[model samples]
Target: MPVDFTHPWVGRTVIYTAAHPNARPEQGIVTSVNVEARIVFVRYGAGTTSKATSVDERLQFLDGSDLILWK
Candidate 1:
């Protein structure tokens, strides 16, 4: 089974997902961190290698080159 999204590890990881089944680093610049929403709003650009993506349920199984930020 995939790790629980509520796990404390979520804060340590960059982009959370079930595909990786592990914590991965973000490749972009995080403009804002929505702790209440548990979502990271960032700008997808070159400096941040990863593309821009709005994660509905980042803790879910979504996985890709998208970059996100967390608090």
Candidate 2:
């Protein structure tokens, strides 16, 4: 299914499970939405090592089924 970029995803929490089963899942909050680019930026990390990644690349636009969005 195509992603619905029209939704206000910012501030929503999302779980990102890496493609590799051995990798731990990361929980993050949506930081930004770029509908034109079809990219969602997420901020996630532990302690002082905060980081961000484009959801489209990290989750493959949901094609990998690695993202669990929480309302």
- The per-model lDDT (C-alpha) reads 0.42, 0.56
**Candidate number of the best lDDT:** 2
Task: Give the Cα-based TM-score of candidate 1 against the true structure.
Answer: 0.30
Report the Cα RMSD per candidate: 11.2, 7.4
- Backbone clash total, candidate 1: 1
Task: Give the winner by TM-score.
Answer: 2
Put down candidate 2 lDDT per residue, 24-67, tens digits, no spaces: 86776666665544556677755333344544555533233444
Model 1 residue 24 CA deviation (Å) reads 13
Error of 2 at 56 (Å): 5.0
Instruction: State the lDDT at 9 in candidate 1.
Output: 28
> Local error of candidate 1 at 47, Å?
9.6
Give candidate 2 regions above 4 Å deviation.
1-7, 47-71
